[model samples]
Target: MTNGSPSESAISPGKPGQSTAVHVRDVTMDFGNGALAVSNASFELETGKFLTILGPSGSGKTTLLRMIAGFETPTSGEITVNGKPVDSAPPHRRSIGMVFQKLALFPHMTAAENIAFPLKMRRFNPKTIPGRVDEFLDLVKLGGYGNRRINELSGGQQQRVAIARALVFKPELLLLDEPLAALDVKLREEMQLEFRRIQHELGVTTINVTHDQREALVVSDDIIVMDGGRIQQHAKPVDLYRAPDNAFVAGFLGVASFINGHAVPGGLASGENFLSGTHAGDFADGTAVRGAVRAEQIRIAAEGGQLTACDTRLTGTVRDTIFEGERQLYVVATEEIPGITFRIYHHDPESFGLFEIGTRVMIGWNARDMKIFESRAS
Candidate 1:
C-alpha cells in the first residue's frame, strides 16, 4: 500500500442514550463441510459509529456482512441488534437498511419513488410516504433531483439516491457492501467523504465491507482486518497501520519490510549484522524471528554513523526510485540479503540528493522501530 499520508477527519462517538447497535459473538459459518467462511468473529458496534470490515477477496468480509444483513445464516453463534437476538430474523424485519454494489435502483422509477419503496412496503399511508421521501432526499442532498429518473442522474447522484432509499425508513443499522466500487476513482473518494457526512447526520450505526484498505482507513471509526475467515486485527485505523499484531496484519495494512533474523546473546543476528530491539515476547537465544519495519521509519545516510559498522546497518545498492509529488521512494538491494529490498521515503531530495542506479548506500532504522515476530515451523 502507498505510504503517503491522507487527510483524516474527526470521528464522533455514539450518543449517550444509544444502545449497542449490533453485537456479533462467536459467529462462524462453513460451506458444504469445507473450509470456514467465517470463524469466531466477535465485536460490538455502538450505535451511530461506522465500522468497516477490510479484507481481500475470499477473506470472508462479504459473508460476514451478509450474515449481519440477514441474507445468510451463521452455522453457529448469535447476532443481536439493539439488544434483541436476531439470528432468525428476516431481512425485511431486522430494521436494517442495505445499499448494494450495483445500486439496484429501478430504472423506471423516479428518485422519489425509489426512496419511498421501503416505506410503501410497510403500508405507510400514501400521504406520509411523500413527506418522508422529500425529507430523505433533502437529507442526502438530492431534494431537487428527486423528480429525475434514475437513468438521468450521474453515477454519484444515483449513489446518493440509493443511499437515501436505504435510509428513508430510519433503520437502526445500515449495511453498505462496496457501494462505491463501481464509480471512478475520483468519485469513489468523494463519495467516501459524503458517506461519512451522511452517517454523522443520520446518527445511524453502519457496517461497511470493502477490499480497499485506503477507503476503509478514510471513512471508518474502527477497522476489522480479516484474513482466511478470521479477524487478524481490530483497532482504530491509525493503530492498525502503525502497530499491527502480526506479520499478516503488518504486511496487509501498508508498506512494510521484513528482516529475517535470530535473537543471539547480544542482539538480533541476520547475515553479517546484529541489531538490538525489543521483542514481542520472551524467546530463547538463537530463536528464529522476523523483524518488521515501516518504510517511513528508515533513514538514509550519506556519510558515516554508528550504524555503518553495526548489525543495524544494511548496505545496499540503489536499484530503483519512484518520484511521487511530495516524496521519493528508493528501492535498495544488499549483497548480504540478496533479493531482499528496502523502501525508504525521502521528503527532501536535496538533503541526500537523488542517488543514481547502482550507487551504494546504507539504510538503517532505530532499534525501537523494529518489531520481532516469532518464526513458525513450516
Candidate 2:
C-alpha cells in the first residue's frame, strides 16, 4: 500500500481487551482460473502469540498470508482484526506491520530516516518521531548504527533496520513473509532466535509464513500445516511433533519412516512382521494402512538382544551410515519389511561410526513410537 492517505493512528486500529488478535473464518481464495488458492481456512491468533503457517510451494501458505495482510480479499470468508472485519480495509489503513524477504529500505535513506519514514507518513507528532526512532533502533539492537546508509550496513544489520522500521510505530500485529529466507544458514538460525527474543520482549502478536520447518518449529507458539490449498493440522509445536493428526503431518514435521501394510487383529501386518502402535481411529481387519516411526525413536540393538525395553523388534542390515556433526544416522533395510528402509538417529556425540555399513544389527522401537494411520491411497 502507498504510504500516502493511510490511517494516522499510532496505536492498533483493533479494539482493545479482545483476546484474539486476528480471526480468519472459513476463508477461501479462488482466482477465477478454476482452482482455489486457499480452501476454507480458519484459525485464530491470541494476543501476543507467535504463529507460523508452514507448507511447501503451491500449498497456499503465501496466499493465506496475503489474505490476512489485506493484499488479497477472500472470496468466501471474513477476516477480523481484534474482533472487527477488515475485509474491505486497505493495507495501510490497518494497524499491521509487515516485513518481507526483500528489506525494501530506501537506499538513499539512513537507518534512522528509514525508521522515521512510517512515523512521518502516519503523521505522528513531528517532535516525538526522533525519540521514537531512537527507541526502536535500540529495541532492535542497532542503536549506534542508525546513521549508516542501507548500503553501508551488513545484510544482518539491514535486516535489523527493516525490523526497526516495521516496529517503530508499534502496530499491534506483525506479519513476516519469510523475512530470513535470504540469509546464510548460520545467520538465519541466529535471526530466528532474534525474532523470538524481540517478539517476547514486545509481546506483539505475530504471524509468519515460511517453507522452512526448522524456522517454524524454532519460533512459533503454534503452527498450521497446509497442503493442496487446505489446512491439514493446527497445533502447538511440541504436540504437532509428538502427535500428528495424519500421516502427511507426521512425515512433513519430522524424519519419520513409512511402512505400508494392512490392518490386522490388533495392529498392522507388513510382510511377515506384526506391528503394534498408537492410532487415532479404529481400523477394521484387512483395511489398508501404513505405519510410521520417527528416526529418533528407533535405536540400534545387539544382534540377539533388544535395546532399552522395546516392544517391537526387527533385524536389519546397515546400508548406510551418515555423520552429521552432532549425530550419526544409520539407514537400515530389514528383510521382514522388504520395501521399507528405516533411518535412525544416534545422538551420542562421541558415537562416530558406531555402526559400519554392511553390518547386521538389530533395531527396535517401543510400540507407542510406531503410529498407525489409514493409508492415504485407500
Candidate 3:
C-alpha cells in the first residue's frame, strides 16, 4: 500500500446480524528488543461510524491502524471484521478500502481512470464501473474534473480522486492514513470538512489515523488517544474534550496551564493560597497533584475590574504574547502561585495585543473550570 498501490478488496456487502463493524481485543505488537509498538489495545467500532486514532509522532497510532488494515498482524489478541475473526486474512481479503497519505493515484491516468482502477481490479462489471466512477466524482464535488490528469488537478482534487478510488469498490470498511496531512492549514481544514461530509453521506464505517488534534475533534464521532504505544482514552469528541481522564489528556486536548500543589480540602493549596478545582483522581490531604485549566476558560481583565464572578483570582505580569490571527495568546507569570505561569486566550483578534508584554492583568477562573489530577510521582 505504501508503494503507491492500495491493498485492494473486492466489493463486500455488510454481514447480516452484526452491528459492530470492527472489533479489536487485547491487541499488541512487538518489534523485538522489548519494543512494543502497540500495547494491549482494544476497542469496538459500530457500523457507519467515524473513528479517529489520534496522537503525536511515534505514538503507535499508525501502527494500530495498520494492524486493523491487515498490513501488520498483531502479536497477540484478535481483530474481528463483521463479527468474524480475520487473524489470518490478508490485506486485500478483509473487505477494507484504504486511502494513503500519498494519495497514490497514478500520475499517467486520468482522474476517472484512477477512480475506476479499484473497480476494474476487483472485477466489477465493466459497464457499471463508469457510472460508479461518475457517481463518486460527483460525490466528491469533482464531477467534470475527472477528465483531468492527477498532476493537472489541485492537491484537494487529487485527494478526492484517492478517496473515490478507495471507495468505488464499496468495501465494508474504509481506512484513512492521514490523508490530509500535507495540505496547507486552510486547505487542510477545508479537506477535513469534505472528509466528514463524505463520510456522513456514504455512512461507511471508517477509521482514520492522524496527529492533528483539531482534525480529530472536527471529523471523528469517537477518538482514541495513543501515547508511548498505549491507548490513553477513547470517547466522543465533546466528552473527550470536556472530561479528560488524566493530566496528559487534559494538556494534550487544549492549550492548558498546569500548576503543581498539594491537595487541600476542596482543591489544591500552593503556598498560603488555595485554588478550588474539580478533581478527577483520588486525592488525600496534602497529596501532591497538578491542576490543569484551559487557556480560554480563564477570564482576563484589567486588575479587579470585571472578575467578580470568578472563584479564584490572581494578578500576573504578561511575559509574552502571540498573535494567532483569530485570537491572542497571552503568557502570564504570577509569583503568588509558587513558580507557575498561566496561558490565557483572548478571542478578540481585533484587539491584537490587549495587554503588551510586562503589563499587569487579573486572571480568574471558576472552581469547576480547573481539573486536578494526581501526580504520577505521588
Worst 10 residues of 3 by lDDT: 1-10
Which lDDT value does model 1 have at 276?
Answer: 62
* lDDT, candidate 2, 82-142, per-residue tens: 8778755677777788898797889999999999999999899898887778778887889
Which residue pairs come into collision in candidate 3?
none
Q: How many backbone clashes does candidate 3 have?
A: 0
Best prediction by TM-score: 2
Worst 10 residues of 2 by lDDT: 1-10
> TM per model?
0.89, 0.92, 0.92
Please give, for residues 267-306, the per-residue lDDT of candidate 1 as tens digits: 5778767766557667898899887777887777653544
Candidate 2 ranges with C-alpha deviation above 4 Å: 1-18, 349-353
Candidate 1 has a TM-score of 0.89
Which candidate achieves the best lDDT against the true structure? 3
Once fitted onto the true fold, the runs of candidate 1 whose alpha carbons sit more than 4 angstroms away are: 1-18, 264-267, 303-311, 348-352, 376-378
lDDT of 3: 0.86
Full ranking by lDDT = 3, 2, 1
